[model samples]
Target chain A: MKKSYITAILLVVFLLTGCWDQRLLKDVRLLLGVGIDYQKGNKVIMSSVVTRNLEKKPPELISTTGSTPRDARINLQRKLIYVPDASKNRIVMLSEALARKGSILEVLDVFYRDPRSALNAKIAIVKGKAKDFLETQSKDNPDLTAFLDRQIVTSEAATIVPDVDLQSIRTGILDPGEDIMMPYMGLNKSNVEILGGALFHGQKLTGTLTPGETTVALLLANQKNKQTTLTLPIEKGVQMTVNILQSKRKLTIQPTGQSLKVSIDLQMNAEAIEMPFGDFSDQKTVAKFNHTLSEEINKEADKVIKKLQAANCDVLGIGRQLIAHHSSYWNQIDWNKEYPKINITSSTTINLTRNGILE
Target chain B: MGTRQADKISRLELFFFILQSVIGIGILSLPYTVFSESKTDAWIAVLLAGIAITINMMINWKLSSHFPSANLFDFLPTLLGKYLSKAVSVGYIVYFLAVAYLVLLLFGDIITRWVLPRTPVLAIYFLLVSTSIYLARESLSVITRFCVIVSIFLPVLLILMLVPLNSSHFIYIFPIGQTGLEAIFKGAKETSFSIIGYELLLVIYPFVKGNHTQIRKVILLSSAFLTLFYTFLVFNCVIFFSSEELEQIPEPILYMLKSFSFRVIERIDLLFLSIWIVTVLTTFVNYLFAASIGIKQLFHQNDHRHFTLAAGFLCLLCAEFTGDRFLVQKISDFLAKASFLFVAGIPLLLLLIIYMKKLRWHGR
Candidate 1:
């Protein structure tokens, strides 16, 4: 009788375990990439790239419109035979028009509120309609999501854009003293390319940086990736290319009489990757080369700083530094109005650490 | 020695028991809760709360050692007489039941929301309370043994917390002490609620076999480790998220873990939550066992086995009423306020009475 009772209990356990929350892979479609565009009459257009099976078949691009992102997703789900699961989504793109409206947090509220939404999806702002970028196909890679994601990631590694994601950008967007910079993608024929970066004052897109200016901005911000190469035009069109190996930035905010004096000191160690005009064999020549490069970098960095101040984007977190070290001063001034009037200066110093295989 | 129980736990088992009991669902939202009062200086508040809990633990130790073989309920009547002691015993039982109910409620809420939204919360409660009932029916030695085995996951959780520091900005906690000492102290007051389970020492002291010095050292060491562990986690969350972002997220640790997707593991938060369920179970079992002991003492029974199932049922039933989010928050705040009175106020008052009674006896 005891053995019979034990067998019955084992059978009950097997029959009753995990029947409610069992999500099978075959029953759901994985939505890998999402693109949000602002439509007429304040409607939202959501374009999703859904894959039935990632390895076996290519993904399909579907677009739906509704009042909000979740509403659009519900519309998108109704059309699909299987349920769309966004837990594995890797990228989320916003149109420049939608991003400019400062409704970024509103569009992303669903992702943050839903427990199953992916938080690490790469976030970007497209120059035109985000649906166009999502629909753009390539000959080499049929999956447009993977194609665009790889391009943004590669540009991030090259120090041409800031590595901002849905999770990483939330802090910047929410913080009063800081701003966010997202990778800006532009469509070129059948291919997509990361142009530079879209700068946001808070949640609104204020301005943008050119690719060269983006590298300089990121370098001065002390965010260096694997390969930060700079091509500087010297006198008589003698252009030189240098790869920045290491970078350090220091922000000092001091009270000068009535106002504050902000100075950004940027130091970098670089290697001459492709400089046919200069000789690094002599130490003195290398020193002069370093001086010349530093002078040019300082000029370019000054331009980037001026552009940032004009756009009211504190990408370098100078305002954050003020709030941290100079709270007394921070509380007194209206940072938004006073930011343009502040005396902010930057100086870059480049040390030629290596000359590559050449001397 | 004559008052010792049949199953006496060693110094090590006693250490794990105290350590496991003090940590539970509180650690997940600790940073968010403390950040509301102190902002970036929340880690300091955690340390202050740790020091206060240490002092409370010492007072409980001194009171328990005086009646070396008598647990809290066993010696209550000797100090307060039959009626007053019985009333206090009932209060203590109610406190234990409330704590168990909260743990089970929060466990079911988190699992249903995070891991299995489709799974019925009643099924989750059944799985948790049944396991707790099974282990709580055993002796103290078996429970501590289970606690010791589960403590291995604590280090794994620590390692997982370190991953978010890759993108952390330490400058977020700058302008130290900007919130002022008053706010910091208030933050400490807030954390005293999360650091609630140290009172278990009053109940388990009689069953632990050790010299007075060893017992005191073990208790102090466990509290110190707990304080440092909590401080590290809070510090990690503070630096990982900006002050504004930290205020917005209720569970910063889990949210921070959710952002990291490694090659092999897609969702680290789910893995962390699954492991965390075990710690929550251990904490629930600790409270269940304590309540059952109170029941045994009230009935004058030698074995606590009869009341374990009853106490588990009582907690499960109480948890069903707290389905509303606002109600959950209300009960949590009420429990925090009640914790100070039961865990510290009454225990200290009991010790005072014991001292006065001893003085009269000696004078005679």
Candidate 2:
């Protein structure tokens, strides 16, 4: 009798577990890209690309405005037939105006607070109207998310821009000694293109570095730059294109009695890929090529440093090193004002290891 | 009692039993909690808590080995008077039930917020308690065997946590002693509440099938293992996030996993959470077992199964009070403070009392 009673209870339990929150695939929309724009009325406009079938149809673009990003999402929820989920959201794009107006941190609160938010979603700043970028329809590309993802990943490998996600953004903003820089994107003739690095002082967008300047910043920051081609003029009109194989950076923060002295040393190994100058006849030419490459890198590095200093953006994490090793020096001054005045120097050395098939 | 005296647990079973009981919902928020006091030195605080709790575990073993084949419920009357012992047993019962309910409440809240939005909170509450009672209703030997089986998830949990280390910033844990020695100790004091499950050693020591020396070795090994386990995870969290970053994330371990997405599995963190439910069930069963034993001794009942059912009902009822996040946090602080008295304070007093009585007997 007890055995029968237990079996019956187990059967009832099996029956009672009918799916309470089963969301069918056809009934839910997968949000791929979200674009948040700050408006002048102390409001925000959120735009998202939602799709029913990923491989079959082009995703639809939708926009709504509210007092906050989450509020805008709620308002957008009203217009959609199916439930919109952001857990699988691939990318988040903010307009230049919105990022400049700041409070991007406040807008990001929804992503951090909601457990369903995709923490690893790639975030980029749109150089123009973010809504326009989100509104760009898929031409040959099946998915805009796929396009943007490829662009960001490709540029990250090529060292055109640094990789930044929502998680890094939150940490960078919260971190006292360091700031963050994200990929700056723009609407091209057909698809999205990575422009450069969008520098941020805390949550606010301070300025931007051009593509050339961004490459130098990345190299000085000890970040990888695969397939990066460096064109150096060994002679007056002779330019050699050297492909960077590996790179290393060493940053030194010297503490004096009055202030902190910061400098960065960079080393790179490269191979001549498209040397338009001439064939490498002897070891002397390779040495000359290496010297020319080093000088060119140093020149660009100095330019990048000057731009960063003028913008007062410490994307190299100079302040982080000071805080970590020399906290007493960090506590003495206001970093925001003193950062622009602090002189940062950079030196680079290049080694042309091989000349590919020519040698 | 004479017939059941043959039931004994092996050393490996005891190891897993202690492990499962100590690591529950506490792991999900422990690093974040410890960081609030120790900052970058949170791992140091975790290490200190391990050392402190091991001493307490040794004391429990000493007290329990004195009365072979007997639990705290049976042997308390010898140390304290009958009335006081009865009162202390009742207090322990309430403490166990309260802790079990808090774990249940936190479990339900995490599931509702992270996994299931539409399922009623009571559904998880009922399912967890029913399964826990099933495990708790068994003999000590069977429960120990179940714990051995449940511990196989530990290696998988470790592998999942290690996956994120490839991308973490090791520099975040730098300036280690910057939070200072005092803050680290304070964090260790705060962390003591999390290591509460070792107190079960006081009750289960006699059931362990070993000599006094073996029991001491087992206790020390489990305590060391738990300390390393917790400190390893805490160290990982410190490296993965800065103090500012950890402050905002309530569950650093889960949040760290959320950042890592495997190609085959989209969210490994959610999978970790699902497997973690089994570990949480082990803790629930441990507390329920402890509480029911207290009830049996207090009421002079031969069948502890009835007491286990009553205890489950009381846990569910109490869990309802901590439904909101604010009250859940409030009662969590209250439980942590109260745990020090029962798990640490009273155990020391009992050991001292037993020592004094032994001294008196020797003098006579």
* Native contacts, share recovered per candidate: 0.71, 0.50
TM-score of each: 0.97, 0.96
How well does candidate 2 match the true structure in TM-score terms? 0.96
lDDT string, candidate 2, B187-299, tens digits: 99988887789888877877788798987898899999999999999999988886688998888888888877889998988989988999999999999998898888788
The true-versus-predicted C-alpha distance at residue B151 of model 2, in Å, is 0.8
Q: Distance from true position, residue A76, model 1, in Å?
A: 0.5
Q: Output DockQ, candidate 1.
A: 0.69
Pairs of residues at least 3 apart in sequence or in different chains that clash in candidate 1: none
User: Over the stretch B1-364, how does candidate 1's per-residue lDDT look in tens digits?
Assistant: 2354668898898888987898888888899999999999999999999999898898899999988888899889888899999999999999998999999988888888888899878778878887788899998889999999999999998999889989998988988999999999999999987788879888889888988888999999999999999999999999888888899899899999999988999899988998898889999999999999898888888889869989998888888656697899899998999999988899899889988988999999
Q: Is the docking of candidate 2 incorrect, acceptable, medium or high quality?
A: medium
Runs of candidate 2 exceeding 4 Å displacement: A1-18, A137-142, A188-191, A225-227, B3-6, B321-323
Docking class of 1: medium
For model 2, how does the per-residue alpha-carbon lDDT over A28-118 read when each residue is reduced to its tens digit? 7888888988788989889887886545767877899999998998898899888898888888899999999867888888888887788
Best by DockQ: 1
